[model samples]
Target: MQNVTVKNRNWDIAAHMYFPEPFDQSKKYSAIVCVHPGSSVKEQTAGLYAEKLAQTGFITLAFDASFQGESGGVPRYLEDPATRVEDIRCAVDYLTTVTFVDENRIGVLGICAGGGYAANAALTERRIKVVGTVVATNAGRAFGELNPLQTLEAVSKQRTAEARGADAMITSWTPDSAEEAERAGLAEFDMLEAIDYYRTPRGSYPTSCNKLRFTSMSALITFDAFHYAERLLTQPLMVIVGDKVGAFGSYRDGFDLYNKAASSNKRIHVVHGASHYDLYDQPEATGQALEKLIPFYKENL
Candidate 1:
């Protein structure tokens, strides 16, 4: 594995590239682009999946989204869905330039919000031969449902404030601790685990700060990850979600994608007893997901 940088529109995306053992540049190989969840960095779950996929004989890349992690962008922690979708395409742009990479065989895997971005990107980025999503969350629907009118009003106020030179606001996915989550009436099983995974030693990393620009709420609330899937998303698709991810309606998003996709080749894999956060780093759950992913990419890409 090696750390690298790819130049996007106006940012430098930091990424980790994993090469298969005994890699030979003369022989072209299929490549997979792994996208991380919102407010998360590549070094966390994205890198884990990339490394695992590389062991299965595919060159894989996990990249930090623009304005987040090690990537270059203004107003750090901005979680713009459109830019996130384009980031996947930008990664493909880099992959196509590598002599050892087979341009015709490219796949994309997205986790959490990244899954939505991957699906959106595949709608038009025809270079993506296959699309896999792990515990995918439709950002627009998920966040919008959390009091849409109120949140939109709040975002409008924040935008006005920022325009008046006020400091940008920041929001977090997890509370500082599980106790805080419980006290705040957000102590759902998946919610608590999400906090533990990203905030505790279980999966915490310096760059995975779990922060997002408050101004991003507008895009987060309006961007549909699976927009136009019924017409444009014809690539082979696989949506994986844990049965225990009911707390956040993760399975609903996966099912919606499966039901709406126009792809003739599509499958939904449910990992029993695994919650949304468990799929992030749990070995047993992640292993089950990889079992499906390995074969899907092998046959498609």
Candidate 2:
């Protein structure tokens, strides 16, 4: 695993490059930029995907977003939707300069919240020739007025407070520990599935750039992803969503949105009997999911 720092539009980005162990420098391989989820790091499931994709004869990169994990920023864990989208483009921009990558054959994979960023980035960033998202999210509906629990008045107040330089203390949805689990606030959200991957040794890494900020709530509440989704029809989009998600109802809603995009080619695949997290790392499920993605990008990109 080799780590390198790259520059994004407004931030200094941290990216991990995984190439075949032989590490050939002269070959210009197709590249896939993997985007991480909200409150997560590159070493999580998205990093796993980047490594796996790299093993499949493509150069892959997984990076932490600005203000999170290993990436640079002042107000940490801030969820700026537009900035998040630019982060994906930033990865693409950085990849183009790598001699190992064939600039025109670049692809992107977004996991969980990263999926939404990848999709929105492809809307206008034509350099992203191929795109796929796993357990994708619709940032528009997940935040701002799209979140059912938040009202426009609430967003207005939050926006006003943020503009006034209010010290943002964003509340985190994930439990801090077993003790925190007992004090967990939301019922449907207190699942052990997330705990196993996030807090446990099964996936957690020390270098991961994850810092839960108190201001994330207000920042996220004002972010929406599907605002310009209809304009993405000129390119190709492939969306993969799981069959079961009791908490995330709109997990696949972004797929429906992309299908409506002005895109020339679009596809949506539902993994049978799979939960949202299952699509993240379950071997059998991910194998099936990538079988679909491999063909899609091969034919499109």
lDDT of each: 0.92, 0.75
Q: Model 1 compared with the native: what TM-score?
A: 0.98
Per-residue lDDT of candidate 2, residues 1-301 (tens digit): 7898878656698889889656789887888889988778888888888887777677889999887888987677677777788888888888888888899999899987788788778878899988888987765556544454555556567667878987564565466555566675433542455666677787677754335554455556655555567765456888888777656544556556566667667888888888777777889888888889877876876
The most accurate candidate by TM-score is 1
Q: Model 2: how far is 212 from its true place, Å?
A: 3.4
Per-candidate clashes, comma-separated: 0, 10
List the candidate 1 regions with Cα displacement exceeding 4 Å. Answer: none
* The 10-residue segment with the lowest total lDDT in model 1: 242-251
